[model samples]
Target: MGQAFLPGIRYDKMGEALFCHGEHVEEPSQIRPALERAFKSAEEGKPAVVNVMVDPTLTNLGAISMAYAVLFGHVPYRDLTKYGKAMRRSFLGFAFPGFEKYGIPDAPWPDGWEPIPPEMWER
Candidate 1:
C-alpha cells in the first residue's frame, strides 16, 4: 500500500557481464524502434532494456489494459464497444474472489494515437 524510492544506480557500472544498451521509450511511437534497438543489441550478444513508460494516470486494470493494447498494436478496435467487451473478458480472466466486484471501464486510446505496426511483433 506504500511506495518506496530508491536512488538510481548506473547500469554500466554493474559489471561487464551486465552491460546493456538502455533505451527509454516514453511514448507509443518510440516503442517499436526501442524494441528493435534492444533486439539488435541482444543479437550482437549484448543485453538491452526497452523500458516503455506508461502514463502515471493509468493506475487501474482497465486503464493499464487499454494502454497495453495501444502501445502493443492490439488496437484500432472495430468500435469503442469492443474495447469494453475486451476489458470485460480480461477482467473475468484475472479477477479473484475478493476483487470480482471491481467495474471494468470502457477505456479507449487517446485521440490521434496510432497503433504500432503488426510487423513489430515479428522477428
Candidate 2:
C-alpha cells in the first residue's frame, strides 16, 4: 500500500499543471504541518492533498470494537461513551483536547462532557 503512493507523489511534482499541491506525511508529528500547508495552498485557490502514511499494522478500534469491548467488559461503558462523544464533537467542529495545540479551533464541550485523553484512545 505504501508503494502505491509513489506515483501520486511523482505526479504532484508537475506543480501548476496539476493545480494541486501534495504533501507526503511520513510520521505522526508531520500531520499538522502537512495539513496546515494543504489548507494554506487551498486557500490560495489551489487544491491540495496530504498523503498521510499510516501504520498498516495498527488496527483501528471503531464501532465494532466499541460494542465488543462494552459487551465483553473489556472496556468500561462510560469510557467508551466519553470517547464516542468526543468523536461526535470533533465532527461538529470542536477539536479534541490535544488536537487544539495543532491549530485546530477548540470549542467548549457541552456541560458534563470532556474529551477522553489521547492516551486512552486505544485502550
Candidate 3:
C-alpha cells in the first residue's frame, strides 16, 4: 500500500460563511499566528476554524494529561502494576498479534519517575 499524505485544505464556502485562506501555511512555525487569529475570533463570538498542518516529528503534547487519565483511569497506587500490565497488553499485544512473549522495553527514566501520590488518586 502507498503512504498516505495530508490532504489540501479546501477554501470553498457552501453558503454564507466567510472563508479565509492560509496559503503555504504547512509548517510548525506557521501554527502560532493561525491560532492567535482563531482565538481572537472565538473571543469575539465569531465562527472560526484554524486549519493547521501538523508536523509528524512534533510530539503532540496537547492532550497528554487527558490521554493519561483515559488510559489509566484513576488507578490507585496499590493497583499500579495491575493497571500497567493491562495497558501494556492492550497497546503492545494487539500490535504484535500472536507474539505474547514480546517484551515491552522499560521506561527510559534514568533516576526513576515519581509516582503520583496515593492521596491524589483516592478521589
Top model by lDDT, which number?
Answer: 2
Q: After superposition, how far is residue 99 of candidate 2 from its true place, in Å?
A: 45
lDDT of each: 0.46, 0.48, 0.40
lDDT by residue for model 1 (1-123), tens: 011112353333453346777876658998889789888988998888655555432334434353444443443223333433444344333443422355534333432244423332222
Count of clashing pairs, candidate 3: 0
lDDT of 2 by residue, 1-123 (tens): 001112335434555367689887779999999889989999998898776765433334442232433344443324444344333434433323544555534433332233334443442
Per TM-score, the best of the predicted structures is: 2
For TM-score, candidate 2 versus 3, the one ahead is 2
Question: What is residue 100's positional error in candidate 1, in angstroms?
Answer: 22
- Per-residue error for 64 in candidate 3, Å, reads 10
TM-score of candidate 1 to 2 decimals: 0.36
My TM-score estimates for the predictions, one after another, are 0.36, 0.37, 0.33
Candidate 3: which pairs clash?
none
Give the range of the ten consecutive residues with the poorest summed lDDT in model 3: 107-116
- lDDT (10s digit) by residue, model 3, range 5-90: 23564332311156432233467887788677666866776656655555332222322233443456455423444323333344
